[model samples]
Target: MRSLPLATAALTAAAVFVPSLPAYAAPAVQITKVYYDSPGKDLRSNTSLNGEYVTIYNATTRAIDLEGWTVKDKTGYTYTIEGVILGAKKKLTIRSGQGSDGTSTVYWGRRAYVWNNDEDVAYVRNARGKLIDSCGYDSTRYDYKNC
Candidate 1:
C-alpha cells in the first residue's frame, strides 16, 4: 500500500475542520437613535406629556416583537410597551401620551410617569432577560441623543 504524502494529509484534515466553522448569528435588537420632543432645562419638571418622548430605531433586519420589552426610568420603574412589533430598520416612538399609528410615529400610553428630563437611561431587553440595547441622556443638554 502506498503512504499518503504529508501535505496531502494536512490538506484533507483542513478541509474537514473548515466546514465546521460556526454559523453567523443575528443580534436581538439595538437602539440606533434617541430623542425627546421637549427641549427644556428641566425634563423632570416637564408637565406636558406630549412634549417628552423617546424614539427607538430597530437596527436589525428581522422584525422584533416589543410586547414584553420595557423602558426603565431613573427610579427603576419600567414602562412596558404592549402590542408592539418594531419592524426591521423601522422606528418606534414612545411619548408621554397615547399610542401612535405604529409607523414612523409611536405614542406612549403613560408618558408622565416615565418623563424624567434629567440624566436617564433606556434599557431594551428581551423576554429571556437578554439586554438588547442601552442608552443614557442628559436632559440638560440635547433634547434627543442617538445611542
Candidate 2:
C-alpha cells in the first residue's frame, strides 16, 4: 500500500475539521422605521411629500459610511445618500423632497410625492448593490409589512 503525501493528508484533515466549524455572518444594520405616508391636508405638495421618510439604524459598534447607498420607492423615485456617516448605534432618516442635508435627516429632492398613499415599498441598497433592508406598506387599510 502506498502512503498518502504530507500535503494531501494535511488538506484532508483540515477539510474535515473546517466543515464542522460554524461560519460567522456580519452583524446586520437594519431599517428601523418607515414613515412612508405623511399625513396632512395636502399629499401631492412638496411639503407633504417631504414629510415622508425612511429611517435606517446602525446596530454595530463602528461608524458606517453610507455614501453611494440608495433608498428607493417601488416607484421610480430613488434617494441617493451622499457624504453621510452613521455613527455606532445611530439612526439616519432620509426624507422625500428638497432640503439641506443634516446630521439626522437628509433630503431626496423630489418635487412630487414618492410614496403612494395606498400602497408602496421602499428598498435600501449599499454601494455594492447588496440589499440592506426593505419595507412595505398599505395605508388604505393600515397594513404595514416587512417593517
Candidate 3:
C-alpha cells in the first residue's frame, strides 16, 4: 500500500508543522531595571542632556497598558508612551518633563542630550510590533540592578 501513503504524508506534515511553532508567550514588559537620570539627584551624572531619565521595570505578573508604547532615540526620535500604566512589579519613569514652554520637554530623554553623553538605545514597543522591551545604555550606564 505504499506504506499507507507515506504514513498519511507523515501525519499531515506533523500536523502542519506543530501549530507553526514559536508560541512562547510571557513578556508583557520585563525590563527589571535600567537607569540614566540627571534631573538633579546627582547619582554620579555622566550627563544625558539635562534632566534625563529612562527607567522602566515591570517584571511581569500582569498590569501593563502603556498606551501605544514607544521610546526611540538613536536619532530617529520617537517617544510616544501616552497616559501610562505599568503596575505589576512597578517602576516606570520616562522623562523629559518641564513642558509648558519652560523648555526641556521632548519626551523620553529627548534624545538624551543629543546622544554620546555616553550612548543610548531604549526601544520598548508593544502595540503589535512586539519588542516588549529593550535597554541599551551609556552615560556611565547609570543603573540596572536586575536587568
Best by TM-score: 2
| lDDT (10s digit) by residue, model 3, range 51-123 | 5656666677787877787766566666677666777887775555333221212244343343234666666
Model 2 segments beyond 4 Å from truth? 1-27, 141-146
Clashing pairs in 2: none
Q: How well is each residue in 2-102 modelled by candidate 1, as lDDT tens digits? A: 35687788888988886566886534566554554465553334355556666777777888788778766567767677788889888877666664456
lDDT of each: 0.66, 0.80, 0.58
TM-score of 1: 0.62
Order of candidates by TM-score, top first? 2, 1, 3
Position 32, candidate 3: lDDT: 43
lDDT of 1: 0.66
TM-score, prediction 2: 0.75
Residue 40, candidate 3: Cα error in Å is 16
